[model samples]
Target chain A: MSEVKSKIKRVSALKQRGKVLRDTNPLLAVFQWGCNHMMNEAELVSDQPLILDRDFKAFSKVQVHNQYYNEQELPNKFKVKEYCPVVFKSLRHRFGEDPADYLTSICDGQIYGGKSTGKGGGDIYYTHDHRLVIKTLAKEEVASFHHTFKQYYSYIVECDGDTLLARYLGMYRITVHEKETYMVVMNSIRPVGIPTHRLYDLKGSKVDRKASDKERAKDLPCLKDIDFEEAQERLYLGGDTETFKETLKRDVQFLEKHNLMDYSLLVAIHDCNEQTPGEIDRDVDVYHVGPHAKDLKADPKRLYFIGIIDVLTVYSTRKRAAHAAKTAKHGARAEISTVKPDQYAKRLLEFVSSMLA
Target chain B: MSEVKSKIKRVSALKQRGKVLRDTNPLLAVFQWGCNHMMNEAELVSDQPLILDRDFKAFSKVQVHNQYYNEQELPNKFKVKEYCPVVFKSLRHRFGEDPADYLTSICDGQIYGGKSTGKGGGDIYYTHDHRLVIKTLAKEEVASFHHTFKQYYSYIVECDGDTLLARYLGMYRITVHEKETYMVVMNSIRPVGIPTHRLYDLKGSKVDRKASDKERAKDLPCLKDIDFEEAQERLYLGGDTETFKETLKRDVQFLEKHNLMDYSLLVAIHDCNEQTPGEIDRDVDVYHVGPHAKDLKADPKRLYFIGIIDVLTVYSTRKRAAHAAKTAKHGARAEISTVKPDQYAKRLLEFVSSMLA
Candidate 1:
């Protein structure tokens, strides 16, 4: 017994000991762990693969299976497949991010955004810092992203950061308990440190155009069509409306060309007291939006952050049937959440431009 | 919104979800993670390095400084080093264990044995299966292990596991938060799933040879010399005394040769109602003890798990000084848990063999 005591004494005297932290929960902790695991694996992939034409149709998938013994904290196994990994890695760099920092920001930290799974059923996750949004995508959406990934890359390159479309950073397939979850990460509509007083997901539709009572109760409700109409919120491009509208038209034209539909302008409004006209121009990518008008007084302190989101859907024969079916339910004359690609593009442009002040 | 709903509908129809478990805690979980990490790294160590004469005196160290990321679950970093990795890896094989299974059983499952850090100030850990004991070694003890490791390996080879000495498996140096902890793993005295009704750590000295009332309150308290003597127990080696005594003698002589002291015979009595002759031989490692003679008809089923533990101490100059200081306090013939190596070995063998049953 005294010998046991002596051994303990020596252990206490152990030099330069490391700390061990308790996990938040098993699932979240394992997710963080898996991020480390996959990132390490990703390091093995040949760096900067030549961007080939066929790379658009390619997907890099990684599967992990733990057969026996690791059942304590982890189950028998899991699989994580990254879609078009090379493209995404390139996209990461194009967005001015380092892979290591990106992994840390996404996978490390307090993990705050577990907003209730919306009516759509798939979960949406926002990183603690609000710099990233991890949104669940359907298998069809993943296929659609792969379908357009090459052209999408070309468009971003042509215009640099001027496009208004949701910038696709990375996509993944995580299988837990054998259920596959397709997720895509993109930049949040607003800057991380900025405070947003209001936000909206505008589809320019009239029917079912307001936030539900529950959605309205949220701290920053993603309000919709009639809600925006009633609030009379307008896009103020200052005097640079032509340039901003050109980027929007080109972005929408790309979606329309691909027969895509049902995307929206995701908008966040940050109200700051120190609203100098050029404050935003100095801070954000000036190419993203039109410049502030020299004539307008900087009386009300507000800055707008907007980007197009939810553009993965492509109109096919199946969507034609949906268009016909939705027309029957919502009526032919009224604007609905779903429509044909050309009609959706025309209606979105007219509705958005009509809001310019 | 409809598109999002449709995707959700599709996501719901997808199949084969796997479970993600919550971690037990941060530290223990990280230990599990680090095990996976180090084992993967171990794959790179060249196999069967030439066992040089001086190899027994060496160590293999790894220092990890993760400057970015993994700060939540792990510290910004950690270090893990193996003591004579090649020797231990070979030792693992010599003990009839596969490295994979060993790693799985140890690093995968929920860790179970966190023995109270005794007065000696080190914690003892066991795998959930209880087949192995992870004990913390002092800096001095680690040095002493290096001193005697070569001879220990030779002794095990000579006897072919037919002795009472504890089997050494592997040694490690782990640093978390800069603190260094020295650990060594060995075979447990009691086989997994075996029930020991009473156990005693026997040193053969009587200066303080009784279990405290607190110790007696334990389900299987480790009683001492006076307790054993008061109970009036005797050997029941079933007429195999000749073989058992020889093994014991060989083990003690080896200890005496090393000039070590303060070792103890960890004895456990598994009192059962289904004791059948030769049952132990059918189940346990037969070489560990001599078989019971077929004549005995004791009905109560029991299995005694006996082995030597705490054999790391050497009669170095510091130990000699402690011996002199203790001799002055308890008097020259007090047998105060510290004695000359030959005297300690002779006394321990006599006491342990006298109790075999």
Candidate 2:
């Protein structure tokens, strides 16, 4: 109804279209662009003060139009959103990341699946450099993330990014081909160039918590609580248990305070004799502990990898209902992922500390 | 505490910060960065099919960290969000905007306030070439925009970008210094080089809709509905009355259908005899109607600037409440901006068509 008629014709006049990033899917390409865009924007505004509680509940969103980077492989339009940028940007800063470099790592890198042995249904990707892990989130998990975002961010800031919790570098939602994918980027637990003989997802619950026969049939299967118990794997904390326990205690308290359940202590054991810890790739491990390799009493028998993973589950009305259902099904004493936050935290800490000796 | 301690030290490692756009504030700098980022990203995903109704509610968000450019002037960290990118991106395509060129026009070019004669309370900026107008939106106005966003997009698509309403290009929210600013970008109604000797805001309402004496004191004051009536100046719509009225009729239907109120037709009359319209820079006016200069009937008497402004108002509960109060205070027959959508649309169409005759 505009009388103007808009006859100028400027849209097609430019004709200079940017090429898409080479060799990727529509989702990944759009995601990469969002990452690049976000980092670039973050760099301009990172000098602001630390994130507050309210900031964690907020998001910085971007919408891409026709002239995005790769027109050929990517969709002409899509939506990408980053939740709690203030919290994560500071988290990245505390982790000593250069924003520009972060942009390159995500945008330039190829994002293929992280070679899952097929036990898990969720899709996961490893950054080309194997530094960052991009894990797809379920709808409910995404809701849980938002539900506890404020609490999680506060805990991270209070601990000064020093906790054992999985370092969540970023969270994003990208809509492609009419489907929405929510993802969270974290510091990878799987170290490159190091053959971790075994890995365990320790929830400290023994009831039906063992890796199935089908799961164990695969190479590099993620062992579970029962397998860990059966192996009698004592954690080799390298005699630095005080500080480690202190931090772990604080992190568990945080999980407990927020009613988070089902989180695990990811454990990777690297045999020192087979691969000496002499040249430790510190950049590859954010949760390793020892008298530094340069110290005189460095142990050659074992190298331990530890970080708390799967902290996104919060006990909400839905989760509470799940807990009730599981209790009814497995009887009240069953060890389930939906245990009350307090009991869950108490059991997790007890299991982990007993193994540390 | 993180056992790694991150001895790699990368912050000082990469000291080369990307250059900020020259001569801009932190808000504008981050905005420019966001535009560039979004454009780069959209290119990759622009191949996606058109947006559906569900897509209208979606958004793309990004969070930046410590490495944001122009950290000194910008907040250490802030947020930039673009709502409903899928719809707007495609809508931009319909209006003939190359995503890349739109990027350059907003990000690369120098952005300064559109030279206002200083009559309005809100801030308005123009692209360097004066092509786009960026105006701040109030909190309620932002909500209204979202409320009507779906309907507005659907109407635009149905009409093929044919409407007297402003070509709403984009909407963004940026948080800086603990305060958030909402902005909308639209095609400017000011014709380049054509001096609009007089401008009037015609709402067709007589409820004390007159510019105050203080407002009249300004160098280029915006005359109101009362002033317009007293002047008794009929709109010179030339011989093309049928199409204009038809467009007006349809536009009114849209406004009424959406329960919108308080919007006005912004009129700027460029006195062509003062400076012949022959050397008219068409690029300066993205909405010019006449065929190029060679047409014999091209009148040198006048150049009119027209576009609907302030269309974000919706007849929400609050507006309905206001309407009741106004009716009680000013009597039902008294005219005001808070009139019901039906009566409002009818009265508006009546006033405009009457002006044309």
Candidate 3:
């Protein structure tokens, strides 16, 4: 009788344990599930030295059916599509990110939704460690990403992942209840354990380029070009200036060649003087210190994290029409967000150059 | 103001979600976590066709630290050790199990604890689908497993996974609060969606081989030799009799050569008349049907699952002492559980042959 009682207690305890794994956000839960699944599947694949042309078009899709008895707190059925797995895996290798560590950061712990949504109206999330960012993308943006992915991969390989462009880690499409959501994972431009005193999203455009009144009301608003100019903000890269400028020039030129434009230079400034002395996670926060921080002439009070983001947008016909109207109204010399790729790249480089001290 | 309010609501909702992932069973949670982590790490390894001697000794150990900010509902610190990964992986392949599917079966769903513990005092768990069984092992059993692992791997390779031996899938050691527990994963002998009307753990011994009163009180008690004899149970294998006997002979010889004894033949009988018509999962329940079931003089109402289990126990010094003491007490000719490997095998084969028709 005592043994039977103990057995009953254990079985009930397991039932209680099962209840604890319930999904709070089904979408995020599915996304994490897909990541864990695909990453494990990728282990069986043999390593290839060269990425094949067909690899760019390749994808793995799985539809999961959750049975009644299973403990998975997911929808009854959902589909996950991983695009260009080999290409993305190579990109991850190029970025020096360990696949295991990447899996742990995204799937092993909580994923927190961003307090504010992206300008593109996509939802944003951060890993528990704040080492990676996940952003939902529009269908057209996914198409645009596929269009530029080949050149983008080649550029990443050539640059050895040293450019200031966003380090894209993985791309996936998740479908639940017939609704499809495309998401991209990237290294977070902000470092952990450091508070950013000021942030700027620079597009080299002055007209309507300042942070909105509503945006400014937030504790850490993304300030813009006009705001940057208002504060006369400058980055003291010192000896690292030439290397930084050269990489930016090459990156923008590559984007121009691909007819990509309207990308922003996201700069986060951490005031070293204000923060308590602590060890910085250099591996995760790769952009925290410039390569030549030990070369002297460094600003002891400020540490900077800088990267180019939103590079997926292309200068389409609609953008060209908007540019023509803006040019007609404000004269051809007027600084605007939308312009020819060449002119946009040149203006961004010049604007960035002015910020260097 | 509305945006801020919405953001607050979202944050609070997420907090509520995090609270839902609380751990009711920290040990099981950690086991699941470790499986996910290790399986993912295994994906990054290059495949090898040949299993080396060192592969048996090889192991991977990881210590996980769950910080306050992380959502992992585990102890603050725990250690997981995976034993003979490459060898086990090869064994899985030999058994025609996909690594990815194996990972998903254990990690993607809830693992239920058995209603009754094993006679060895080990806790038992089954995958949500009931396709796999996980049993906690004593430290000595783990050591015994390692001792025979090389010969076991060779035997498995030679027989090509066709023998009626337990299909060992994975073994792991988990540590929490400075305490260690070893666990092994194996294919479940019983078929899914089929009702087993009678179960038996036969060792060809009458002395102390009968199920206890407590065991007999269960819904599905594991009967013994005395119980089987009293009921006059027989297996009508017909055409499969020779093949079954041949395989059993070879398996017993293998065990005898390794000085192992005290193993049992686990037999589960599913009475078709007692079960509802349903498709049996053949992939998971590989032992459900006999090799020559079509040529079977078999009972239409009965389907059998038979496998050799508990084969890790070696006839060591302690067992030799127990054999002498038992022989002295019950007379040398008594059908006892403990005996020399050669005598034990002969007695078991003779007892099993008598029940075959």
Q: CA lDDT, every prediction?
A: 0.62, 0.67, 0.72
**Tens digit of lDDT per residue, candidate 3, span A267-343?**
88877667776655434444433221112125566777888987877788767898899989989988877789998
The predicted structure with the larger TM-score, 1 or 3, is 3
- Specify the highest-DockQ model's number: 2
TM-score for each model: 0.49, 0.51, 0.52
Q: Is candidate 1 or candidate 2 better by lDDT?
A: 2
iRMS of each prediction: 20.7, 15.5, 19.3
Residue ranges of candidate 2 with Cα displaced over 4 Å: A1-24, A67-70, A114-122, A276-299, B1-357
Candidate 1, residue A288: lDDT: 42
The regions of model 1 sitting more than 4 angstroms off are: A1-30, A57-73, A114-120, A273-300, B1-357
* Cα error, candidate 3, residue A239 (Å): 32
DockQ of predicted model 1: 0.02
- DockQ, candidate 3, comes to 0.02
RMSD to truth, every model? 21.2, 13.8, 21.3
Ranking by TM-score: 3, 2, 1
Candidate 1 local Cα displacement, residue A29, angstroms = 4.5
Q: Candidate 2: lDDT of B124?
A: 78
